[model samples]
Each structure stands twice: as structure tokens, then as C-alpha cells.
Target: MEEEDEQEEMYEVQEILVDPKQKAVRIDKFVTDKLPRVSRNRVQNGIRSGSILVDGQPVKPNHKLSPGELISIVIPRHGDRPDGIVPQDIPLDIRYEDEAILIVHKPPGMVVHPGVGNPDGTLVNALAHYLSDTDIPVLPGNDNDRVGLVHRIDKDTSGLLVIAKTESAMSFLARQFFDHSIDRTYQAIVWGAPEPPDGTIERNIGRHPRFRQKYTVFDEDEGKVAITHYRTLSDMYYVSLCELKLETGRTHQIRVHMGSLGHPVFSDEKYGGDRIVKGTVYSKFKTFVERCFALCPRQALHAKSIGFIHPVSREYVHFDSELPEDMQSCLDRWHHYVDHRRANNQLEP
Candidate 1:
């Protein structure tokens, strides 16, 4: 039998100092309150495994905090964390490349990094292979598997992506993303035209309680704030093409926000855009819609453009990509459908 490759485990250490005015709180509660996404149970497990320390000594979950004490926690890198990423001979659409940065036009169905289920053949793997001859430094204090990524789009959403070739460049671009200075615009075909045509969507987004794989809008106190500004570009009656600008980037922010507005991206299966949301019940219309879906098998969303300050040159740079063939063909089909209907006076007033 062939020897199986064991998944590599990585650990990250975080340290915190006890405040002078801090009360005697349990270590588990203190760590949970400090870490936003971490749960108390996980912290307790780490404590049980001797992964948590106080002033260089292992501590229990119920250990009481004292003023002027140092606390340290060793966290396992898992859950969307990349293991050992093997270099693969995957093709990449290089839009722009320089010594410190590279802009890639990511195609639909390409994962940005390695994660559960998708362990290979990702953009990162391809980048690793392409950069094997060069000295692409691993990001400091990050998973080595993701050496170049500053930001990412969804797997099935095609568009422009900027990659950092150096640690300084990565830090500079990551800061831009944190400050919301990086300009990113996406083009999407949605099921219905948004009311008023142009507007901003401000909602909190978090993982759904029932559907672990899906995200949903939540109360302000429950989830992180997400904002998206959008305007309709073309109205095809049942569907509308729109341009969306993200003010804040959250997981599934665009998809969840648009779904909340009743205009999910066309053919987004996870968010209920696969079924006809705005069309007649007739069998012919259903068949036509199915054909349109077949034309663009994935969600009709594309990262059309991105702009940011160059980390090394300190000059502003922008890049744009034409719509992928799949999405373009789908839009052309819709345009032809609309035009033919209008010519025959079949469109509703």
C-alpha cells in the first residue's frame, strides 16, 4: 500500500498582559472574551492539553487572573487553515507582475488557498510552483501555506486578485484592506432588480446557526458589520446586472447581503438563486431559465476591477478584467432574450 501523507499540524502563540484594574476572572472567560471567534470550550480543551500558560507555566481553565501577570495561549491552526500545500502545475492568468507584487486574474472554480476538501490545485499551489525559482518569503506570523495572499474572493467567483511577493508588500496591502482603502468592484447578474436601482446595504453577517457552511445576516450585536454599495447596470426584467462596491469584507458578504435584499446572485446554489426567483411558472420559461443556468453554471459574480497603492513603488495601480466567458455568455443570452421579447411586443409594460 502507498504511504499516506499525514496532515501537518501548526501552532500559533498569543500572549496578553493582565490589566492593573482587572478583576479575578477565570482564564477561560478571559481568553474567550479576548478572542472574538474562539469559543470557551476550545479554550478549555487547550488548557486541558497544557497549551495555555501563565508566566511560562501551564495553567488550567479555571485559573484566576492576577494583576500584572502575563498569559500565553498556544492555538492550533485548523478550520480553514491550510496544511502543507504541494506545488502543482496549474495555469494562472498573470495580469501584471513585478518584483514585489503580482496581479492575477483568477478564473471561476479556482480556490484561493488550500482548505478542507480542497487541498491542492489552488491558486496558492500554482503560485508556489511559479515562485519556486524566486525568493517568495513566507508571511511572518501566518500559515506558511498561504505565502502571498492579502485578500481573497470566493472559489466560484472569477476576478482580479493582487498578490504580495514580499513580507513588506503583504503587510502594506493587508493594512490597506484593514483600512478599507483598497478599491474593489464586482459585476454580478442577480435574480431581481433591486428596488430604487442604487443603494447601500449595511447589515451584520455571521455564520448561520443551522447551516454551518452558509452565512446569513444577523443582529448588530450578534455579527460583524458588513456594508455593500450597489447600482443596477442593466435590467433584463427578471434579472438585473449590477455593479457592487464592498465597504467591508466579510465571508459571503456580497452573497448574503444581496440575498437579504431579495436579489441573490443568479445561479448561486447555496443561497437559493438556482431556482427561478423571478419568472413565469410556464414550462417554456422554466426551460429557458434552465438553459441560462447551464450557460453560467456558477454564481454570476465577477471581481471586475481592483485598485490599490503599490507597496514598493508607493504609486497607485489599478487592474481590470473582462468578464469570464461563462458569465459573458449568460449575459449575452439574457440580452438577446430581452431584445427578442421587446421586438415582438411580448415584454410586460
Candidate 2:
């Protein structure tokens, strides 16, 4: 699910008012002093970006701040910060937590970390706040924004993610992912039933040439090797529910592979699943499909389960989550349509 997607710039403007009894000080110094994590260089960078404004006008980094003046600091919500991650009070659906690890259910449309268009309001920001009071050490070699994170899913792919609370734990869990020793299963609603009910897709995946934000399958000599094993759980003919397991975790591996097999994951706009791929061309069918799209506005894929070896206990641990409401609602609609068609002896050929 972690694919290179287009990003839109977003800014978080923070306004500060000079204290009544404050002395005239350089703006950069004032900013670094006023903000907890803001550094002098970051303030200067913000000034250069015209993000630091005094009285609604951009000022030089050495501009003197006077009492009662309103200073606005506009910082990109993304990972452009030089200081560290910003902690926000965002709620998290924590599934499991211990000394060495944490598991959480990420909802659809929530970015895993701060980047590009999503600089703030991410799962990492939430983790920053959640662990603010704890003594959990940040992962070695990782940015503070991605402190405990070892893996990431797409913004729209709802699922469970494992987080490492300590450096040793981080290395331990990361090794499992690198070795493909981690067990992961995803449930996706894809267009049409695959030819072989159960099969494996082995292909090389790389970023598209023209569309840098998107990915495409490539020759063996080209991109990275990716493997996905899928089995049909239910076949409604026009669309089927599938369970996919990964042998290698590549960006957009499941989506790209399913798309290569002519079974794009339902509602995956980037992979052509947002249209009527397998259903009839009738107006009624179109309406039904459109309704389903509205129900699940994002890709109909869920990371159902994950299994890994505990870093502390060395015991195997597994976690599972139910399908989110949007996906479940979309599937229910498809089930109802299929049942109605079967009852009328008009099921699609």
C-alpha cells in the first residue's frame, strides 16, 4: 500500500504574539526561544520560504520583534522540519502493546507518516503524542517522525501495523520483514474472478516512467522482484473477494499484481478499478457500481492479519482485524446484488 503518490502542499500556520513585557529581539532567536523544538536554522528557513511573517508581512531573519506584534510561522506539515516530529492529539485504535512492541489498526485515508502533502495529522504524529510520556527510545537511524515505525501501508489501505518500541526491537522486527519471515494476509475486493482460484503472481515492480507517482510491472531484469499469493474467498462473477499473502513486500505489490492479472482492487482509482471493469454496461449496473464506489471511496483492501516473532519473548505473535465499515458495506451491497440476480435466474454469464 505504500506507493509513491501525488502530493499536495499543506501548511500549518502557527501565530505567536510578542509578550507585552518582552524586549526587542531578533525574529529567528525569538522563534527558537518561543517554540519548544524550533531551531534557529529552521526559523531562518521558514523566513526564506516566506513562512515567517510579522504583522502579515514577510520579514528578514534578523527582523526585530516588538511587543504586541503578531508573528505567524507557517511550516509545511510534511517532513521538511529540521527539528523533530510534531506531536498531535490524534486518537489511535491500539490493538496491542508491550515493552518491546505496539500494534495498531490504521483507518483508511490516514497517512502513516509525515511526507509531501501529509506533513502532520499522521499515525506517527499520534504515536509521538501517545508515547510522549513513555521512555521508549526512538528507532536507530530513523527520523524522529517515524520513531517506532518499521513498516507503512498506503493512506487508503486500512490495516494493522507493528511498531517497535526500542532499538533492539526495531532491528529484530525489521530483520523479519527483510527476510520475508513475517506472515501477512490481506483481504481485497478485486474486479472479476481470477482464472485460477488460487495462484501466485511473480513479477518485477517499478515506478512508471511517465507517471512518477504511480507504479507498473516490469521485466525480470528491470525492477524489484515481487510475489503475491492470492486465493478467491467469494466470487460474485463481476467481482470477487480475495485473500492475498506476500512473499516480498514491494510498494503497491498487491494492487499492481492484481491489476496486471486484470483484477484491479475495487475502488482503486490509480489502477483502473474505479470504473465498471467486469460488470454489464447497462445504466442500472453503472449506477450500482457508482453507489458501491461511494460506499468505499478508497481501495477495498484490508490487512487482515499479521504474524511475527516477538523481539523480547522470542514467541510467535499474530494479530487480526475485522473489515472496516466502508469495505464491509460495499461487499454487502455486492452480495445483495448477486443474491437478487441469482433469485431471478439472471446471474451474469
Candidate 3:
């Protein structure tokens, strides 16, 4: 017989000082803007629970704070919070780790963290389990939330990711991402070739009509500004490999904008791409890929590199991950198809 195990984590709030230059800012909005990763719901929850204060008095979420006003915030440890971020030994390809930061290469199809349909096996869960034995100092009044989380990549995308080990680092890193100061490069397989080798695709992105699961560039509703720059790396057969640099990190920005340009991600069934390779253009190559390399399951997208200023050391650093097994295999087959077509002069422009 084995005894059951259980543990509890404590949370507390910390003091915050308002800057005179940031006066007239909405308190909740200010916090959300300052802590981009902290969800607005958590911020509101902290306010209602009296875990947050302005000038030592509990304030409503709608209240505005003056610059130079002292702020008292209580941030709870994540384990005790509903967000339930815990560390686990889920095996990570860590490129770098320090007392103030942790960076990993998240594989494709692995969710970043738990969300509505997903509640576990997240990067958040693994992080929590990894730090289960470690001590986390919480602020007195702040609610228990993700402590070191800075930003996120989608479940189906794989690449370099950064995690903050301290609250100070979290805030700084979040600002860098929000202000577009961070350099993130992504590799994608798109359809067709644009006129120039390198070009820009700037458009407003919003939800798609009739297709709620997808996004589009032309919309009747309000949308955020989006921009993507790409350079054609190779053009062979009907597909082209492109490198994308983002100017804005909107939901599905890369996929949607690429689709708008007539090139949805390969294997992307959501954004008008047929997962089946039955089209006349890919008939022969499809049979070859499906037989030789069946490893590539999802879209052939990857985060190739990320560079930023280290929040703790203040030193600039860059990190990169090679294409994972699946994408690598896909590229292998792609190379084969390109050679086959070129050898026979069957390739199209």
C-alpha cells in the first residue's frame, strides 16, 4: 500500500509604486498592460478579493489611479490559483536556463498551457511540476497567477520559448513582446511565389464570416493592424519555402495573412488548405511523401529563432531550434519532389 501525497502553495501581495508620468491610467488596464501575460479576469478577481489596493485602500476595477500614487498588490502563487500552473517532468529541450529565466523548444501539437478545452499536460503544468520542490516568493496582495510566463505560441507551432523565473523579469519581457522589440523569425511552407523575392504583407486582421474558426484580412467588423514580411527561400514545383518576420502578433496572423495571399500553410485544413494531397499538381509527389515520410502530421510551420534583451542580465541573447523530426522529414520529401521535378523539367513557375 502507498500513502497519498498532497501539498499546498501560499500566495501574497506586494507593494507597487505608480510613476508620475503614467497618471490618469485606468488601474486594471494599467496592470493588464504592464503585465501582459496576466489575464484580465485574474486582475479583476484580485481586485474584488481585496488583494489589490490603490493608496492602501481597496479600489474598484473601474477606478483610475493617479501617477505617483502608491499601489499595493497581492499576487498569489500559481499552484494555489485556478490557473493551476504546476511544474512537471514532461521533458523539455531547454536551450538556456538561469536563476531568472528558462527557455525551451516546445514541440508542435503540444499546447502551451491549459485553456478551455484543454486543462492539463500544458507547458504551464510541466513548469509547475518542475518547480514543485522549489520555493516561490509571492507578493502579499496579488492573486496566484502565472509568475514567470511572458508570452505564448500556438499548440500546433513549435519553436523557441522564453519563461521568466522572477516577477520582475516577467514584466520586462512582456513589455518587449508587446512593443515588438523582440525579434522572432518563423519558417513556413506557402503556396505559389510572389513577384519579388522579399516583400511585405500589411493588412488588418479580423474574424472570418461564416467560418468562426478562421481569420481573414477583409472583414466588416473591427480588427487589429497586422503585418508580415517574407523572403522566398526556395521556389520549386507548386510550393515555396518562405521565412516570415512578424510586425504584430495577432491570432493566426501568419496563417491568415498567408492564406489571404493564396498560400495557406501546408497541411493546414482550417485555413482553406486540403490535408489530402489529391490535387493534380502534387499527385506524384504526394504518393512519394506519404510512403517515405509519414512523420509530418500537421502544418509545416516552425519558430526558427528568437532574440531579445535578457531581463536580468540586460545582455542581448538569441536562441534557435532546428526543425523538429516531423517538419524535417516533410522537408526531406519536399527536397526529393523538387529534385524529381527539376530533373525531368516538369517544374512549373
Clashing pairs in 1: none
| Candidate No. with top lDDT | 2
Where in model 3 is the C-alpha error above 4 Å?
Answer: 1-83, 134-147, 219-221, 275-283, 289-293
Using lDDT as the yardstick, the better of models 1 and 2 is 2
lDDT of each: 0.79, 0.81, 0.67
Give per-residue CA lDDT, model 1, range 1-349, as digits (tens).
Answer: 0000011123334789999999999999998898866667657766654456789776778999999999876554333444456777799899999888889999999988777798778898898778775675543313356657767788899999888776556545654665578889999999878998999999998889999988899988988788899999999988999999988778877888899999999999999899999877889879999999999998999999999988777889999989999999999998998889889988753
RMSD over all Cα atoms, model 1? 9.9
Q: Estimate the lDDT of model 2.
A: 0.81
Each candidate's clash count: 0, 2, 26
Which residue segments of model 2 deviate by more than 4 Å? 2-81, 135-143
Position 96, candidate 2: lDDT: 98
How well is each residue in 1-349 modelled by candidate 3, as lDDT tens digits?
Answer: 0000001112333567888787586788877776665667667756654556788676888888887788766544353455345455787677888877788888888887666887667877777666554575432112234535556677888888887765555555654665577898998776666557689988887767778876778643467677889988887455667899888777788888788887777776677544433235556656764543356656777888999988667889998878788876766777787787779977654
TM-score of each: 0.76, 0.76, 0.73
